[model samples]
Each structure stands twice: as C-alpha cells, then as structure tokens.
Target chain A: MSAPTLPDLSGHFGRYGGRFVPEALVRALDELDAAYRTAKTDPEFQAQFKDLLLNYAGTPSLLYRAERLSARLGAEILLKREDLNHTGAHKVRNVLGQALLAKRMGKPRVIAETGAGQHGVASATAAALLDLECVVYMGETDTERQALNVARMRMLGATVVPVTNGSRTLKDALNEALRDWVASVDTTHYLLGTAAGPHPFPEIVRDFVGGIGIEARQQCLDQLGRLPDAVAACVGGGSNAIGIFHAFVPDESVQLYGFEAGGDGVATGRHAASITGGSSGVLHGARTYVLQDEDGQTVESHSISAGLDYPGVGPEHAWLHDTGRAEYEPVTDAEAMAAFQLLCRTEGIIPAIESAHALAGAARIVPALREELGRTPTIVVNLSGRGDKDVHTAGAYFGILDPVETLVPGENS
Target chain B: MSIAEIFAKARAEERALLIGCMPAGFPTVDDSIESMIAMHEAGCDVIEVELPYSDPVMDGPVIQKASDIALGRGVRTRDTLRIIEAVAGAGATVVLMTYWNPIEKYGVNAFARDLAAAGATGMITPDLIPDEAAEWIAASDEHRIDRTFLVSPSSTDERIAMTVAQCRGFVYATALMGVTGARTSVSSQAPDLVERVRHANPDMPVGVGLGVGNGAQAAEVAGFADGVIVGSALIRCVLDAPDRATGLSRLRALSAELAEGVRNPAK
Candidate 1:
C-alpha cells in the first residue's frame, strides 16, 4: 500500500472525515480551507504561530525520563510534559493557532464548545491575548460540575452560555456552537478545540498540535539515542494523541497507541470507547466512530473524565485504527485512577485523569512489549494535561474532600 | 402521486403548495399518524414526516423537544416508515425530512427502498449536501425517490446551482443562516435566495423553509417560492396543547390557516 496521505481535497481520511454540516456553513468552510492552505506554507504566518507557541503558550515542553516510575513497570518510560504548558494542558496550542487564524481572517469574534471547560478556558486565554471577543457554549451539567473552570473562563473575559438541550453534555454544547456559527459565520470564527469535526478542522487541528510529536521525536533521539518502541496518549476526540502521533506516522518503526476512557468498563456497556465499542457514523459535523444505538441515534458516552466523555472519536483516529497504523484500548476508570495515584506517589506528578488513561495503558503494554521486543522497551507517553482541574473529582473519588451539603443527587461523590 | 405532480396542481391553481411537517411518533405513533392525517384533511397539500434522531443539530428547541418526546416513547426508525405509510394512505403527498445518519445507519440504498415502499415520494436532507451525497444520489435514483437538497442565503451562486442540479422533487432554500424555528416575520433574504435558485434553474421548483410561523408569514413566503414549508409552528400547536383533543383541534386550525395562506399568495 502507498504511504498514508490523508484528507484529500474533500477532507476525508480514507472514509472517515468529511463535511456533514449544513449548507449554510459551506462557504465559511471553503474560505477557512483556502486560508489554512495559504497559511500552512506562508513563512510569516508560520513565524507568528511558532512565536506564540514558544513565547506565549510555551512549546517544546520537557521530555523527562521517569526513572522512578519506569522501575515499577519494568520498562523505560518518558513523559511528554504537555501539562507544563501555560494553560495547564496541550489544548492551549490549538486555541492559539485558531485564534491567530481568526485574526488573520479578520473575524473579531471567536466561539467554542467545551466539555470540562479546559478548551473554553484556553480559548478565552488566547482571545484575551489576541483582543478577540470570545463566547463559549458549555453543557449546563458541565457548568455545574466544573464550576471552577466556568468561573475561570468568565474571569478571562469570555461569556459562557449553558446549553440545556439533549443529554445536556458536551455533544449538546457542540450542537449549540454549530447553531451559533451558522448565524454568525461572517463575523465570528468557531475555534473548534479538537482534531475532530468536519473537513479542514481535523487536518487543521492535527497540524497545529503536530508540534507535540515533532518535538517528542527529536527529544527521544537526543535522550535515548533511539526512537522509543511505542508512543501513547489518551484519546478524547484524539487531539493530543494525534498531536503526538502525526510525526510518527511516517517513522513506521514506532508503534502508536491511543487509550480511551472506559468509565465503568467496555464490557459494562457504559464507556467512551467509540472505536472499540461503537459503529461508524457522523456526529458534530464529522463522520467517525460514534457511540450510537442500532437506530443511529447518538448514545451518551460515560467517562469519569469529563473531557473524554464525548461520544465520537476524531476521524483521523478512526482511519488510523482501521489501517492498523495505531492500537487503541480502553482503560477503565479504576485502572486509570490507580495509575493516577501511583504517578503522584512515585514520581510526585499528579497527572490529569484523562492522561492517567495513557499512563495506565503504558503499564498495561509493558509485559506485551517485553515479550514482543525480547528486551526492555522504551515508551513515550504524552502526559497531556495537569491534574489541577481534576482535583475536585479526584478528591471526591479518594474520599478526601469534604462532602459538602450542596452536592447534587447522582453526582460522582 | 409524485411531489412534482402535487406542485403542478398547486401551480395550476396559481398558488404555492403548503407542506406540513411533523415528527413521526411524536407523543405516540397512533396520535402522530392521526395528527398528520388531520393536517392533510384540513388543507395541507403534502406531509413531511421527520424521523426523530438523538442528535438534531439543525433543529430548534420546539422540534427538538418533539423529537425527544417521540424517542422517549421508544419510537424507532422502523416506526417512522410505518408512520409515513399511514400518512400517505390518507391521500396526501408524503416525503421525509431527516438528518443523514439514520439513513446511513439503515444503509442508504435500503432506506431509499424502504422509504419508497412506505409511499414516501422523496427526502429533504438538511445536513447532506451535494458534495458528499454520492451514495444518496445513486440510492435515490435506483429507488426513484426525489432528493431535495437545501440552498441557503449564504450559499454561493455556484453552490446553489450545484445543489439544485442534484435535487429531484424541489430545491429547498433556507431563508437565513440559522437553525429551524418559527419567527414573527419571514426573512427578507428568502426572496433573494429564491430568486437565486430560479436563476440557477428556472424549471426547478423551489421551497422556502425556516422562520415561517403563521398564515401571514406563509402568505408572504408563498408570494415568492414554489412551496411554503412550515415545521416548528405546526409542531408547536400540538406541543403546547393542554390535551390530545386540544392538540388535534389546534393543529387542524393552524393547518387550515396555513393552507388558506398559500392559496392567496401576497404576490
């Protein structure tokens, strides 16, 4: 087979990604496509983007060898410290790139859809820096659950609209954002937060965040004197995973792994493992692996990490899985939480629950790699975010936080 | 009869056709069928049965609520086919308005066959554009069902021409760049979009949807387009009713008023 070149002019990854949005957004998409194509090769645009990533968002995040944690797993592990970015996550890279593009396109307003408000906060940060008007659509349930992040977004001078439709979650927020974009496409830019959604977005986001892999590849060579046997990252719409995986796609020798959130467990029928447990369909303007019922209606996904609770995976991840270029596995909440606690105790790193899935998957693959490689395996795991935002949930899970009287019924506690 | 024949009849009467839209199995399967039949009996020239899906991105709150009620009642895709058959049996031209996923999940060709078998004349897809409709185009052709793709006020002239060429029944022109909902006044952009569609293909029939609520709004839309498509306002009659009898009575009254509005175009 020929080398995997993706998203032909139509924005398809094999058969996974394409525009499935309303006709009203087509012109805007086309204009975006044109601008992105031009900006991709423009030296001035590249210079500005690189400057923002390096000076503002702080790119080239450290690639630290986790010797203490590596000893426990019996494998050499390197952690890509995306957690150290200015916004406390890899999402800052994407928002900055899109916000810059919005400025270039002369769109003064930027709108975004967020789940746990990580992306919303990042977008607001970039908007504040760029002097753009920012509005974020968040699920009403998420606003209540992640009230701290909501307040942070507001403090950044962004308006947060609570969406109350459908399941009242991330998907609803995405739907509401699309609704807003339809009416405001001329003056506003939808700064989509992930490497998902219609054509151009999957490609654009991957390109913006592709620096993760580009940096990691060089770091691995410099530190280990060889490429790691495998690379792993958590997949929620697969932005960070794709970010770290893109540069490895052509390497062919390196293995790429994506760990999805298994809320209860995949067997329990309540996980966010779209590739492992769902079928091919369209949602949020992209055709990908979606957790849907037999009748094709989207089935709500469950994950302890609100960021990974989306029902659909990015189209590029679906394509990668289909081609066997990457491996995906579900890491149950219990297993992820175990990894979370282990990382804090052993390495003094409190990783985000979303990134804990990747850490857990790294542990799970140690024995398999040992058997396959006939020696100790070197693995690079993308620690995509910090645990600061997840302190409340983790505290509640460990029964360490005070059980407040205001806790709603059926809340995690 | 075909959607074209229905439009031809309305054209002969020197009036635009009024197409009434209702979600299948809203409230319940039986009541939804009864409601559609009542609309036809009152004055609607055609019935558009919407299949309720979990994620309706283009729908406004009213239709979304109705779809949720239908899905909550366990109305499945197969039930929608049955509803279409019943509504068509009542002697009104019937079509389906749906997002693309359910049909893709059902298998595109299989859905076209089943829709044709159920007496649906065509499908109006809000999300499926001509650029990504190769499979649907072929399936619709093989099953001989009309494919009505939408052209929006934001659609470029080239895009409008491309979208209208794939359409078989009639070209749907979204009046504004917004989701479906009833408004106090029809958008002024509707007339311009209709004019653009006519320029794209003079022979192709044009239907205008979005933001049209009462008879006056319908009459204003009928003045320029070939068909006046009303969804949210029609569904709202049943949605806000106090009881089943009241819902049906209100639906009949609105249907008649909208029907009368189409008969006497403002033009």
Candidate 2:
C-alpha cells in the first residue's frame, strides 16, 4: 500500500539504513534487490517460501504464557516461540530468505559469519536443506566456547574457519567473511545474518524478518483485542527487534524496548551495549552508533552471551534510538543468568542467553509497569531461542556440580 | 634520506611518487599497525592513515574488514593520531585518508591541533566536498595539515579546477568508480581520469586510488598518475594470519614487493 510501509532502496527505515557495502557486492546485492522485488510480487516464489516455512521448517510457532514466571516477576509474560523454528532461532527466517534467493540467482555457495554459532548453524542448516555449499567463519574463541555448535555445523556440511584476528570474536569473524566475499564476489553470496551490514542487507533483512513482527502483531491483536503495553527483544544486531518493531512503528502506543547485553556489567568494561555506550559514527558501511574509542578505532567488545557480544549495532537500531521511536536498555550477565535460571526453575523453560536479556529487562520493568498501571500489563518477550545449548555454561554459573562425582553410580549408600 | 625526502626525490627523479594507503587498522589493529610500520620500514613514499569508521561506505570489504577489526578493538581517531604520531615519530611523512565524523567529534581546532602535534603532513577526506571543506581547510592550513581532497574521472572541469585550487597537499585521484580494494583489471580508460586532474594542476601530485590491490596494480597505475595509492593489496597479504608476528612477517615481505613495484613500473 503506501510503499509497503517498508525501507526505501537506500535501506532507510524511515530515516536510517542505506547500501554501504563494497562495490564488488553491489552487483550481487542489486541482483538480490531486483530478485527480491520480483519475488515479493511473484506468487510462485512466495508459495515456495511459504511451503518451506510450513511443511519443511514448521511455521506459526507457539506463543506460550508463563503463569508461574509471570507471578514471580509480578507481570504477565508471554513467550513468542521462535525457538521452535526449524533450526532453533529467529535467524533462520533471514538466512532462509537469503539462501533461497541465492539459489534463485544461480549462486553456488553461501558464506556467512557467526558469533554465538546460531546464525552459522542456521545458515548451514538452510544450505544443507537446499543442497548448496556453505562456509562459516567463527572466531577462534567462539569455537571453543561453542564447541557443540562447531561440531553441529561441521556435521551439517559447513566449513567452520576459526578467525584468529583481533579479539577473535564475531566482529573478526565478520571481517573474515567480508574478506572472503570481496575475494569471491564473482561466485558467492554473503548471507548477512542480521539487519545490520551495508545497504540493501539491512532493509532486505528487515522485510524478511518483519514476518515475525507482522505475525506477532496480528496474533497479539486477535488474542488480546488490543496491543500490549510494550514489546521487548534482546538487541545484538537487532534483527528480531527490527523484525517485530517495523510492524509496530506506526503504533506509538506499543512501547518498544531493546535490551543490549551488559556482560558482567556496564561499569565492568565488558558489555555490548553499543547504543548506551557508543557514539554515532561510520562503521560496517553505514553511519550509525558503534562502540568506539578515542582514536576512532573500534574498541573490542565483550558480553556473556555470544549472540549479543557484537561491538557495532544494526544501523536501523541507531536510527530508532536517534529518532526516539525505540529505546535501548542494557542488561548485565548476572541479571541474564538469573533470568535464565528463573525461567528454567519456575516455568521449566530454559530461555536462550540472548533472550534472557529481554526477560531480565522485563523483570526490572514489571514492577514499575505494575506501579504505574496498578495492574499487570501484557509483556511479549521474543524468546529468540531455547537455552538447551547454554546448559553447560549455565550449570557452571549456578554452582551446579557434577552429581556423579559426588556420589558413586554403582554403589548404593 | 627521510621518507619525506625520498618521496620528494621520487617526485624529482621518477617524475612522481606512489604513496600507498595501508590504513592504520585493517585485518587487525595490530596488523594494521604492523602494516604501516613495515611499509615505513620498506619505505612507502607517503603513508595515508585512514581513520576507520563503522560505516565505510566508500571502502571495499578488504579495507572494511581491516577497519572493522580496528573498530572492534575500540580503535578510534585518537588511535589513528597515535599511529600518525608513530609514523611521524619515525620521521615518515604521513597523510590521512579518512571520513568527516571523527573530525566533527574531535572538533576542528582540536583536530588540527592534534594532527599537527602528531606530525601529520596532509589529509584527504574522501567524503568531503570542496565548498563545505573550507572550515577544516582553514584549521588544517593553520596547523599545516594539508587539506588534500579526492577527484574522480566523472568530475567536471570547474570542479577539477576548484578542487585543485582548494587542495593543499596532493589531490587523491580515484582510479575506478568504486572503493579501496585489490581488483583484477582497473578500467581501461583510467588514464583519462588522471589526465583530467593533471590538466588543471600540473604542479600538484595526483595519486590514483580505488581497486589498486597488487604491486602490478601499483606499477600499472604509476603510468597514469604522479604516484599510485596501493592500500588493500599490501594489507591483503597479511589478512590471513594466526598471530601478529606472522602478520608482521607477511606485511614486511609485501611492503618490499610493493616498494619494488614502485621502483619499476613497466615490467
């Protein structure tokens, strides 16, 4: 309808985003830009994607309300079941679209970067299903921390290259992936995982992911007859938030809160709250706020959660912050860990560390929200993924020991 | 001879010099640092310090990844100044190839003050237009941070003359329609773009940028301009390393290769 209430060609979300990638990827991204336009209008491609999401990947994931957890937090908490997606995260939504588009373009291989290994796994999963070659760049340290994911990716037929440059994290992995794309501009499609990166990508990612918010928005309206007081999601590169936020930007009544991971704590110099801590500047091909230092060299960032450990945020998130359409808040690792454990013990649902930041933020806001309204307000947390993968780390954090070591398995006391 | 004197000699002896762009932060901030240092040791005519930004719209992914790591390292404008200081401290004449935001953040007077303090000789803000550049030009002129600007083949005659008039150091001539990276073949008619700038200002040095990634590219570009700006290629040599030492070793060899290419253009 009115330009689809979507991003312009420059990748603007209202007044943000534009193509800022290298000139090499221009042809490919343009190919993508043109292809996606036709695909959006093409009944065949749309039908194919719909069927894949439905029969192959399982669409319309559940929205579960946690009564006990909500009672503990003194607020109504609803979980948007993105965890139940085919690959176990909302990132699949973006990769599926990008990979399918690559196949359409007759590209042979898909190259992507991973931080928490979720995006890599998701990309690998999609590539495997589509029978395309996949290459994933993961920071060396991330490979160690996410061994299971590393193995999973290898098993799924994706080559995991451990990036050993600079802090050896997701940002470096991105650097490695970009280098590969620059070298292989002729053949490969760099399947950017989030609503970040240069031009076209931010907008493209938003449109594909806007599926989440669109579905959630309509689903929420039908269920409650009105919009919730606030919509919250953890912001790493802000794919999910933008996905959900884009649909609700017109609805000013629905407050949007983005929770950035404050690893350890904000004051500890080991957090990933780029907006809260970073200044507005040029980075990753767009002018946006990033975590930078005095000399303008991007500072190395740290966060307990692998997904939210990125230094630079999505460009649209920067615009949302500047325009005051959405506000960003930082949640600490301890707080997130507490929420992870709380969700597990109280509701028997272990939330992803990335999603735990949102729950923790919700807990902090619940009291104030309750005090202001004098009644509980409906809060939708995009439980981005399940914490099944984070069990080892969570166990160590909660002082949970090896029970087998403590007691003999064969002898009865 | 000093790097400045060597560049000056190249201008006198070779008819022009080929100043390379190995931005202070690429591959890794440390590798970026090592690349610049190794280039200095290998004798880059003049080094361009690119103040890395998150949104490097004009850069290719090679430079983008390099800048990304520096940005990831929390490397900022101050870090670049220190790098300028490091090179200047080594008595190498340094030029900056950067965007405008860091200048805004650092403030005009202070930015000039710091650049002068760091011993920077010139600058080329790729994103700035001549008309809007007067403010920084004034400040840079005051501190002697020569306000060098960029000119593409598509630039009009009037724009060329105006850019030549406004330019302080050398005019940065872009070789291609795109960013700083290594490419297989630069446009065939690249000399026409160089000739356009050389037509207006024969006195000033014109260094060609964009898509010059190898020694051959550097040597090839020299035939077109006063000097060649070889950046992403030198950095690309060390892009694959497990540690700083390996990166430095690779960078040293690449810088030598680049310097050798600069010495002999035709072969």
Candidate 3:
C-alpha cells in the first residue's frame, strides 16, 4: 500500500484542522509552512535534526516487554519507552526539530506553552542547546504544582511566565503564548508544544515526532518477528499518540487506540474525553472536538495528571475517530492510578500518570481480546513519560507519604 | 445607516469616524446597554458590541477581564443580541464584534439573521479571514450585513488586497502587530498599513484599532485613517469607575473628548 497522507493543502484532516487564528498570524503561518517544506528536504537540516535526536536527546528509546504483567493479564504487552528520552518525555523530539527550524528561518527566539511542564523543560533544553532565547508560558496553578519543572526551565535559561488567566492551566498558557506570537512573529517562532493549533503546527509536530513510530515499527519486526495487534497511547493534545500512530496508519492489520483523561468519569462531566464525549468546535486555533458547554464556552477539564488536563485533543485525532481509523476510550483517574501502581509493582517501571492512562486502556481491552481470541494478542503502549515528575501527586493519591510523615514528629522529636 | 455610509459621512465632514467598543453584559446586561447608549449619544458614530468569550486570545488584559466578568455572569449570545437591539434602537450604528467559534457554534446563518433582526449593520470578526469564511460571507451577503476584516502591519500586499476585497465595511487596520490594548504611542506602522489598504482599494474605508486610548492618540490615528476604533481604553474607563453611574459618566466624557479629537486633528 502507498504511504498514508492527510491534511490536504488547506490543512484539513478530513474537516478537522484549519487555520482559525487572527489575521495577524496568517503571514507567519505561511512563512513557517514554507520554511518547514524547504527544510524537510535540505540534507544539512535533516542531518542536524537527526544528530540532535540521536546524540543530544537520545533517540531509539527501548521497546521493553512487560513479561510479568503480560503473564498475569494473559496477554503480551510491549512498551515503547519514550520515558527514557532525555528530559523524561517524548516532547524533546518535536522541540529539537522546531528550534532548529527556527534557527534555519533566521528566528532568534522561541516561545511555548506547557501544562505538566514536560514540554516546557524540553523546550528550554532545546533552546539552550541551540542558543536561542526561550520563553515558556505556564499556568499559575501548574507552576505551583510542577515547581521542579519551573526551576529546571529557569536553570536552562528559559524565562517561565505564569499565566493567571481563565482556568490558570494549559489553555490559559496557550492563550498567552498565542498573544506573544502575534506580537513577536517577525523574530520569534511560537514552538507549539503539541500536535494541535493552526495549519502547519499539527502537521509539523506529527512529522518531527513520527520518529517514534518509525523506530517502533522496525523494532517490532526485528524483536517480535511481527507487528503488534494493537497500539495504544494517551491523548491530551495527542502529540505522542500521533507521533507513534502516524507510521502505523497504512498498516491495515493494526488497531489504534487513544486513551483520554476521564478524570472522575465522563458521566460525571469532569473529564477531558474530547473524542469520547465532546462535540465539534474550535479552540486554540484548530477545529476539533472540544469540551464546551451549551453556549460553546470551553469547559474546565479536571484530571489528576496535569499533562492530560486539557479540554481539547489534536484535530487529527478527531478525524481519526470519525473515520474509524482509531478508537478512543476514557480512562478514569482511579483506573489509571491503579495501572500506574501495577506497572510499578509488576514491571519495576513507574509510568507517568498520563502514560498510565494508556496502560489502563490496554488493560481494559486486553482481557476481552484474550477471551475472544483465546490467544495472547501483542499490544504496544506508548509510555510517553516517566513518573518522576508525578511522584508527589502519586504519593498524595496513594497516601504513601502522608501516614509516614505524620508518624514522624516535627523538629522537636 | 450602513457602516460605509457612516465613513462616507465622516469623510465629507473632514473628520475621522469615532468607533467605541463595549462588551455585551459587562458589569451587567442592563448596565452595559445603558453605558453603550450613553457613549453613542455623547459622540460615537459607530458602536462595536463585543460578545464576551471564554478564551479571548486576541484581547489584552483589560478586555479579557471584562469578558471574563460578562461570561461569569451567565451572559449568553442571546443577551449580546439584546444589547445590540437596545443600542441600535437608540439610533446608534451597531456592529457585532466576536471571535469565530461562538458564531460557528451558534450557526452562522442563524447568527447573521438574529444580528440583522437586532438592527446591527455589520460584523467585525477578528479571527475569521476571507478564505475560511465562505459560510459567513454567504450568510452576511444573504442578510445584507456588512463584513469588516482586519489587516495587520505584517500583512503582505497580496493579503491586503484579498482582505479588502472581502470587506464590505471599512477594512480594520490593526495599528500594531499585537493583541488589543491602549498604548502611549500609536504604532508607526499604522499609516503605512492604511496607505497599503488604500492602494489596494481606494474606495475601501480604513479604520485603525488596537492602541488608540485618549483624545491625542485618537487624533494621531485620525490624521491618516477614516475611523479611530477604541476598545480596551473605554472598557478601562468603566472598570476603574467607583460605580455604574461613574462609569457611564466617564465613558461619556471620554467619548466626547475622542469625538472632538477626531473632528479637529490639528488639535
């Protein structure tokens, strides 16, 4: 079969993605589109991006088989270990590509928005390595929760601006970043952190990060002697999912699954299940499924994992769900936390709460597949990040530290 | 009167058209209508009623705060239309300004029909360009509603021509390349952008917004454009007021000052 292609000239992924920004950003988007088109073909640019991915960010992350969990669940489970990448997530790949592209385009500075601070740290790292002025806009709430990430970004020489608007989360940070981009488009590139936003951004992010799928596909063939039956990844803005799913799009034998943050549950109206529960709308310059109310005001999404606490997913995910190219399921906080602990106990791997959502989704479906097929179905879950950043939240959730800390006395004891 | 007619009349009188903006249901729905009507009576030739949105990316802090208040108060699209109906009933040339999502969600044709029924003469869609606005263009044309598109300083000549061709009212020349806020100095790029718009279509009226705050700034923009649009500064007048009455009076005073400045550019 021919290679999978999407997002026609107008940037529509089957009526999903489009340029929904103000007129001030049109020229900048056009320029970025042209520059990316040219840079993708330039051998020097390709070599530089590849060098950074391999040498600096450490690409070709491990694909480990969770033998204990697989044996217990009566299914074969494999993990694409993006958590091992430098900065502890898959965000660095895209950031490195965009930052290099910024330099190639003669842009001296870059800006980005981060939620869990994973993207912010990755962007800061790229900026430091590339010698470009970097700024990261984060929600005020996020800065307080992800304090370690804030310090890391500052240490990397990227200014972290806390946005206090709206819900004071990823969406608000995105709004501030877009405002900055509009003002500084001539000299700065808005390094969008996800496979979202207007036109070239979603496509560009997917292409740069598609290396995950490219490597995983080859690894699956060499290591497993065949492709996996299903691939699963958590969907916030769906960058990692798209990155890993892009290479498998033309493989008709593979089934793709995207696990959205269910928070409490979709029925309780407190989840970020844009595909599972949302309607079609526009947010952050892209037409996609959004968590909005009756008046079309974007609703606040609640999730224990800051990385997945967004009201919208990338537009291509919406199109994929509509076209039946992929299936999306909501993974509740309880289910994800359970899977997080299970992965820790069984496999000696502490997955990010966001990645745990994908694990939870795989757990939900694997038992059924085992029952139906009466055989082990190989499942690949994209472990998008490490749980190091989420240790505090996990400890609080499991009450692991509270009882112990309370048992110990204060300084007097 | 049509938006074009307002600009033509202002041109014939050798003065720039003074356009005042206020978000609908700000402070409160009734109070916002009263404040806008007061500004129109004082001197505003055209009143742009902003439909408050949850995520107003193009707006500055002042306008964002105002919109937050309005949305927090349970203001809906229907309430914004009521403000337009009341303001237009008071003999003000009313235009609805909003981001594109609300209109898309509200149904473009339905929004156009309701806007026309409320006596609004035009729309200023900040986020909607001509290329992606075929639905809105058809709707507006069907309702005979004027469509005003924004042109920024960074806009290329080709972009300027395309935007102006789709504009039915005056082309909204963004004074600077930033979100809306009152500034101390009008952007140096404003006149050049206005000239570029004129070169594309001389008959198309050009209105500059995104920075004009006080009378002096209005006069500076008035020297080169057909309309001076002020938003964040006017909202700030109400926001800083001690009471609703004080806000209305301050808005009137600011409107009168800006109106005078537009008429007497040499001052």
Which model scores highest in DockQ? 3
lDDT of 2 by residue, B78-135 (tens): 7788888877777677888777657756777899988888888877777665644567
For all candidates in order, the CA lDDT equals 0.94, 0.77, 0.93
For all the candidates, what are their Cα RMSDs to the real structure?
A: 3.7, 6.4, 1.8
Q: Between candidates 1 and 2, name the one with more favorable TM-score.
A: 1
lDDT of 2: 0.77
In candidate 3 chain A, what residue range of length 10 has the lowest lDDT sum? A402-411
TM-score of each: 0.98, 0.78, 0.98
Candidate 2 C-alpha lDDT tens digits along A265-324: 777778899898888755565557778766455667777788888888888888788778
Sorted into a CAPRI-style docking class, model 1 comes out as high
Compose the digit string of candidate 1's lDDT tens values, residues A278-322: 989988888999999999999999999998999999999999999
Candidate 3 structure quality by residue, lDDT tens digits, A141-166: 99999999999999999999999999
lDDT value for candidate 1? Answer: 0.94
Considering summed lDDT, which 10 consecutive residues are worst modelled in model 2 chain B? B1-10
Error of 3 at B227 (Å): 0.7
Clash total of candidate 2 = 36
